[model samples]
Target: MMSTSFLHPCLRRMLSDRGGNFGIMTAIMAPVLLGAAGLAIDYSNMALSQRQLQESTDSAALAAATALASGKVADEAAAKTLAKDFVVGQMTNYAGTASASAIRNATNVDITTSTSSTSKSYSVTVATSYRLGLTPFMNLLGHSTIDISTTSSTTSGTSQTRSALSMELVLDQSGSMGYDTNTCAQYKKNGTTCKTYVVKIDALKQASASLFDALDKADPQHTLVRTGVISYSNGLLRDWTNKVTSVSAMDWGTTKSRDYVTTLSPDGGTDATEPMQLADDTIKKNANSTDAESVAHQKKGNSKVDRFIILMTDGEMTGNSNTWNKDKDQSVRDKCDAAKTDGITLFTVAFMAPDKGKSLLQYCASPGGNYYEAETMEKLVADFESIAQTATKAATLLTN
Candidate 1:
């Protein structure tokens, strides 16, 4: 205030005396220079606050959509509240400048839904604003504060759910599966003759185990996935002996194919007709059973379960005579066609099989199905793991 009263003297001194001009110019430009420097610093702070708001908004949208999609929160009102709470909670670091109530009041959460014949998807959009503090020199020009707003959105169908699955893994445990591959990595070992020689049986166990791991990762709670494994040799006989699939007996860890590959060498032939028939029928039976997993999925409003059959083999169908084997293979083909017609996706693997076995597996595989012919043990494992990843959409997880 006193400096304002002396402006005339300073101006008169600035013009009349060159010796005092530097001090006069400095006094004249000090406010402008400080305001410019403050603006530059405030710009950096504004960028950081905007980034925080955008990140919080993105996280809130994703959380809201996932909760809605996974049946955790069903209604629009609850989802919006969930989103608001999440946004306010995530931006606690920014609360040093703005109160939680201010952030909550500045945020707007909205949701929209899209439903087709089979699936429903929910999208959440979150828009939030943060008031950033400006420097005192800038504020003196009537620019007290600035408001920055950011918005983000996400959809729930692909983001949250893997689409419920009911899969029957029909695997071959015939004598030929006991033969060794070139490379040896031992899950089962001999005293010192070195390794157990990395047989096809061992490879099947590892591959099927990897498939289990993938499915588990995708559906950790076991609410959306129902998997059954059926191993066969010579007929409907599961020569591995310890496992069976039913509504009451669905334990993936206990009945895992990985733990049950020791009896393949003694099992004589590969007759997939009866086992293929059983696999297809089991899927239908479970879907219709009131006590089955479909009932539990229904309670969660995910009753539309997709069906899959993963058929694997090391040799073609065999029987009493060579001619009879062709008829048995025909029956297996019939089962494949019927299963596909019933909306069951079929993935087939021929593990170093001869031409006939490969041809059968290729034919059994649905159109647009994943069919693999793996010569090495590693390829076999990769193929099974790929099938599980593709089916469960494990590669594209978003907050699930």
Candidate 2:
């Protein structure tokens, strides 16, 4: 309370001696500041590690469950091996290339697999310790590590299985399909230069082959997949007619559909109505057939058949043979609508098609994410593969 001027010189010297105050304060508060910084850094690392662990376990569990659902893994031991392999494979980013040793040292991994008459399930738990980077403060606190863990489970089998799929692929083989594109190579025929062109048909063949391969992979047992091929130009080709073949019965082990595609030669005009109607009729007949497969599926209480018509074309509808007074484009749309009304899902692809063709196909496709436009052959193939995977329900993700 006394004024500064009234204080004695010695008292003033003692009160104003602040040369070492900063060092004293730092010395006193250094541990708290460093401890806070260390906690922030270590906690961030722990969060990252936990996220990565969850991702790995989730992927492993889903993969193992899919294998079981598809009958790729026969028993519990095989399922466990698959899950562990997947988990270790996914954790490679965390442990470098030595993930095998990391997985071995992980004490918190528990894999449990169970199967019932109608379903199979895989549960995976991964718990491991991440050594904190040795910050001087954390080391001084004797806290040099943090633990991270995650658990994920997935189930699949007959109960979870989608109904048997009947996919009718209606591909366009018009004269434009024979036109040269850069996607395919031109070959010499009978010592002639064969025009040295890569036709759109060649791209279609390659893409169709890839699509069939994906379908084969999706249906390993082949009991749940049946495919019918219909190639159309001015009219539907009878060669690949109402012949619906099971995945197992195809010439190739799983890719027999490729044979039908490979044999097709393009040489006619474009018409969408005939091929669309043919595909629709084929799917309806097969879906409602009194065959053993349909009866068995009906008996299982899953009477809903998954019917799909994948119509791909490279040109506008030009002919009017099968249409009833409706324009070519309107006729195609009407058929597509009827097919949809009959519980058949439609996927329409416009590959290097004109604006008119693209618009018509867009109208024909199912409302939600069923229309695709591919300006290039590569994109066409990728789209087909994606559709095949979706149709077979091969890709599954864990939500929780």
Q: Pick the candidate with the highest lDDT.
A: 1
Model 1 is weakest, by summed lDDT over 10 consecutive residues, at 245-254
Q: Write the per-residue lDDT of candidate 1 for residues 1-400, one digit (tens) a residue.
A: 3458668888888788768678999999998898888889889989988888899999999989988888788688899999999888888766653578899998899899987634578889999998777888788567879999999999885344445777888888777787887656554455445455787887888888888888887766666777776777776553266444212223333244434443334256777777777777767534354746466557656646677889999888885333337877888899899888777889999998888889989999977758888999889989988998878873234443
* Distance from true location, Cα of 139 in model 2, Å: 46
**What is the TM-score of each predicted model, taking all chains together?**
0.56, 0.54
Off by over 4 Å in 1: 1-159, 185-196, 238-266, 285-293, 299-301, 320-324, 394-400
What is candidate 2's lDDT per residue for 1-400, written digit by digit as tens?
8677756887989998889989999999998899989888877777776787778777777776667666788866677777777767767777566546666466244556666533556555444433334456687688765556667766554345456677888888877888766553555676545547667888898888888888787666665667767777876644466553211221212355667788777776778787788777766635346744355446555455677889999988886342222377788889999899877889989999888889888999987898999988889889999888888773332222
Q: Positional deviation of 320 in candidate 2, in angstroms? A: 8.1
* Alpha carbon lDDT of each predicted model: 0.76, 0.71
Deviation from native of the Cα of residue 323 in model 1, angstroms? 7.4
RMSD of each candidate relative to the true structure: 14.8, 15.7
TM-score of 1: 0.56
